[model samples]
Structure formats: structure tokens, C-alpha cells
Target: MKKVKKGRQEVFEEGKLEVKLEMIPQLLAFGLSIEQIAQGLGLDEQVVRQAAQPKS
Candidate 1:
């Protein structure tokens, strides 16, 4: 019998909040609205916008 391969699991030692914060920029680059990214990631819109900021 052929075995089906499941997707690889991601392990993050930092925390879920950190992972979600990292995803904010990628989500925005993908053209997702701030509200949409916030809702999907279970974060506040303000938080998403803050993460989208360019750091000096």
C-alpha cells in the first residue's frame, strides 16, 4: 500500500505570538488588507499595522 505524506509540521520555540507577528508582513505583501490579516491571524488591526512598519 502506498503511504500518503502529510505536510511538515513547523516548530517555533519563540511562541505563537512571535510566529503570527512574523507572518504579518508576508500576509501584507500578499495583498491582504490590514483588517483581513488581523482577523485571520487573531490579532488586532493596530498590531498588524505596527508590524508592517519599516524599521530603521
Candidate 2:
């Protein structure tokens, strides 16, 4: 049987709002809207959009 692999889990400091910045892409992949992610992250939508862009 084959096993499924998942990304390693990350831990954030308790009582802090900070999350892994790298989660932007994963959240985008999960179909979350830019606005939703931005609002949830307390960041401007433009910053979220920019971060969501693919790197050349």
C-alpha cells in the first residue's frame, strides 16, 4: 500500500498573530480568496495579491 505524505506542520508562538508567511501559497492553493486571506492575516489585499504571484 502506498502512503500519503503531507507538508511538515509548523508551530506558531502562543498569543501571537504571526503565522508562517509561506502559508500564503498553500492557502491560495486551498482556494481561499485573496481578500479573505488578507483580512485574516491583517495585511493589505495588495500585499496578499503580490505575495500570491508566481516568482519568475
Candidate 3:
């Protein structure tokens, strides 16, 4: 995974990261699989899987 720069706001400014993060809850609420969300977002399945997991 690429390291995200601290204090950077590029993703927030552009909105792709927010959109992708929001899709996690939306997909979960709709009972969609991680693979499905990943496919829909053109992200890797593992990325979606990790996002779906509870944060420590």
C-alpha cells in the first residue's frame, strides 16, 4: 500500500477518498459483499475487506 502523507488533504479536496470510504457503510447496509463493492469502485477486493473490518 502506498503511504499517505500526513496533514495532506488531496483526497478530501478531490473527494474520491471520501466517496470510497462512504461506500463501505452503504454497501454493508445493503448487504453487498466486499468483492461487489470493490468491483463497483474499481478497488482491490482486499481493500474493501479491510475497510469493512472493525478498526482497532
Candidate 4:
């Protein structure tokens, strides 16, 4: 049996982060500022900004 890291287990098993990642762009399209989105989503501004980046 392989032991997965605790942090990885929590991040993958719980989908909150994934949901937040999905919401960033949707919030932006709805005219929310980066700071507003971060506050509403309880994420760091940098994290929200990264999610809003172009996917090229």
C-alpha cells in the first residue's frame, strides 16, 4: 500500500478548491473585481488572479 501525503489527500478528496477555481472566471464575467471575488470566495487575491489568467 502507498501512503499519500496528508496535504494532497485533503486537497484532492475535498473539492472546495476545485469549485473555487471554477468560480473565479464566472465571478469575473459577472463584473466582480479580483479583490471582491477573493473576499467573497475567501481566497487569497493572488490565487483568484491565477485562476483568472488566460489558459493558453
Candidate 5:
């Protein structure tokens, strides 16, 4: 019998937040609204908004 391969799993790690931060610009450029990106990334819209805040 042939074994079927499962799809890739989404592993959430500590540094994932940083990765998300980096992708924000590209995501925004792609016309993805904050709410959309948040939902797609399994994150809260508020969290995504906070992360998108500019640093002082």
C-alpha cells in the first residue's frame, strides 16, 4: 500500500511574530487589508495592528 503525505503543518514559534512583522509591508502592498491578513495568518486583528505601529 502507498502512504499518503499530509500537508505541511503551521508551527507557531516565538520568532514567528517577527517574521509576520517583516511581511506586513509586502502583505499590505498586495492589497491585503489588516483584517484579512490577520484572519489568514490566524492572528488577531488588534495584534496585527499593534505590530504594524511605527517605532518611536
Candidate 6:
């Protein structure tokens, strides 16, 4: 597996879920994996993974 550098750290509780959701794509575009984005935003990897999924 490749090493990942920690990116920007963020906190978006309750009211900021939308903001956090919006950031998922931007972070992905920056080449960050779900784990990295979760670490950066202090969230669970699963939460990031779910949020990263396309809306149905």
C-alpha cells in the first residue's frame, strides 16, 4: 500500500454536515482517499466513504 500524507483538518458537526459533504468531492479531486479525508476532517472512515458515494 502507498503512504498517504495528512491533508487539511476540519470539523463540521451537526449544522455543518452539508459543508462537510460538499468537501468530499473537492478532497477526492485533490487525490485524497476516503481514509485520508476522514483523518483530515476528524471523522470515521466509513462516514467519509458513505459521503463520498454518489447520491441516488
Candidate with maximal lDDT: 4
Better of 2 and 4 by TM-score: 4
Task: Quote the RMSD, in angstroms, for model 1.
Answer: 7.6
Cα shift from native, residue 31, model 2 (Å)? 0.9
Error of 3 at 24 (Å): 0.7
User: Using TM-score as the measure, what is the rank order of every candidate, best first?
Assistant: 4, 1, 6, 3, 5, 2
Kindly indicate the candidate among 1 and 3 with the higher TM-score: 1
Q: For each predicted model, how many residue pairs clash, with residues at least 3 apart or on different chains?
A: 0, 0, 0, 0, 0, 0
| Residue 41, candidate 3: C-alpha displacement in angstroms | 0.8
**lDDT (Cα, 0-100) at 2 in candidate 6:** 25
Specify the poorest-scoring 10-residue window by lDDT in model 4.
1-10
For all predicted structures, in order, the TM-scores are 0.72, 0.61, 0.63, 0.76, 0.63, 0.68
Residue 27, model 6: lDDT of: 99
Q: Which stretches of candidate 5 lie over 4 Å from their true place?
A: 1-12
lDDT of each: 0.82, 0.70, 0.77, 0.90, 0.75, 0.78
lDDT of 1 by residue, 1-55 (tens): 1232222222233477898999988998899999999999888999999999987
TM-score of 1: 0.72
Model 3: CA > 4 A from native: 1-14
> lDDT tens string, model 5, 1-56?
12222222223455676798778767888999999989988888888787777778
Worst 10 residues of 3 by lDDT: 1-10
What clash pairs does model 6 have?
none
lDDT of 4 by residue, 1-56 (tens): 24568777787856888998899998999999999999998999999999999999
lDDT of 2 by residue, 1-56 (tens): 12222222222332233443467899999999998898888778887888788999
